[model samples]
Structure formats: C-alpha cells, structure tokens
Target: MPKKERKRLQVVISDEQDALLTRTAYELSSPERLISKSEVVRLAIEKIARELGEGEHLEEYRAILETEEVGEEEA
Candidate 1:
C-alpha cells in the first residue's frame, strides 16, 4: 500500500494551551508508548468532530473560534 499525503495545519496557540497540551501528552505517555503534542491535538480534533456530528452546531463552533481569536489579539 502507498503512503497517503497528510495535510499540515499550523496555528498559534496561547501559552496556557501549549502548557496544557504538553501536560496532557506527558500524562498519557507510558513506557511502552509515548504520546506527543501533535497526537494530543489530533485526538482532540477527532473528539470534537465526533461530538459535533452532522455539523448542526457549526455556527456556534465558529463563533467560539472567532471569540478566542479576538481574545488572543487583545491580550
């Protein structure tokens, strides 16, 4: 089987968010398997997408994202 191309997503997150990701990844890591920040993000995205099923609350999600962006800018 051929390897599939994966898209890259780059975004600037607040220091608090970075810390949380680092901590979560660390806690989820084990001797047999290690979790990374990227993995944590992927897992989070999967969970959110699953919970939002069918995109019924898409607008609410967009509004929250917009509010977070504004809040970051004002900080």
Candidate 2:
C-alpha cells in the first residue's frame, strides 16, 4: 500500500502583507499554482543557511544589498 500524506496547517498573515502576497500570487500566475508563503519563507531560510555556511565571506550578501540600494535609487 502507498504511504498516506500528512495534513496541512493553516497560517495567518497581516492584512497589508496578505494583500501584497495575493498581488504577487496573481502576477506569478495563480495563487493555487504558486507555492505557499510558508514554503517560500522556508526556501529563504535555506538560502541564508547556505550563505552563512561560507564563513568569513560576506561579499555575496554585500553585493545583493548594493544591488537593491541601486535599484531603489533608480526608482
């Protein structure tokens, strides 16, 4: 017999963040098609873990921040 799937849990978001999430979901296709916000947050945590694992090297993070700043300035 096949293994049974686990049940899903519910999460609550603030009204402002919820609106942004919905807008993002629509832009990325449909909310149903996109992964859950929890999953997205988990992936972000994994990325941070990988970055920190590279000890004494923060250049990557610095570059990312610089790029964001530049984009904001342009905007």
Candidate 3:
C-alpha cells in the first residue's frame, strides 16, 4: 500500500468566504481539491504586478516621444 501524505498547517476562513469557495469549487468540478484564499490573493498580486510593469514600459515610451518632440522643436 502507498503511504499517505502528511498534512501541513491548517487555515481558518469566514463562513461567507467558505461558502463562496465551496460554490466555486463545485462549479469548477474541483470539489475534492483544496484551494487557498492566500493563493488566490497571491495570484491577483502577480497579475497586478505584470500590468504595472506593462504600464511602466508605456510611460518610458511616452517619455522618449516627448524628448524627441522637444529635440525636433529646437532644430
């Protein structure tokens, strides 16, 4: 027989959040899987970081265009 995996730490959630999680899990057909609110929050942070990085690149491009326009006016 295969050995069972050891359990890790436990986390508590509010009743409302627990109900939402259960509904989401069932709707997604992942009822047996364990999902963490922390994991969801972490993923949201990562997505926001990626969007901010893209926005920074756009700002850099805008700065370059403004500098080019200033140089053209001086010529």
Best by TM-score: 1
Clash number for model 2? 0
Model 3: how far is 18 from its true place, Å?
9.5
Highest lDDT among the candidates is held by which one?
1
Residue-level lDDT of model 2, residues 20-62, one tens digit each, is 7666545655655776655555565587877788763478778
lDDT of each: 0.92, 0.67, 0.64
Per-residue lDDT over 2-62 for candidate 3, one digit per residue giving the tens place of the 0 to 100 score: 9998555565555776777666545545558665655554554587678768775657667
Misplaced by over 4 Å in model 1 are 54-67
Cand. 1 Cα-lDDT: 0.92
Ranked by TM-score, top first:
1, 2, 3
TM-score of each: 0.75, 0.40, 0.34
Pairs of colliding residues, candidate 1: none
- Candidate 3 wrongly placed segments (more than 4 Å): 1-29, 56-75
Summarize candidate 1's per-residue lDDT along 1-75 as a digit string, tens digits. 999988999998889999999999999999999999999999989978986896667888899999998997898
Q: Of models 1 and 2, which has the larger TM-score?
A: 1
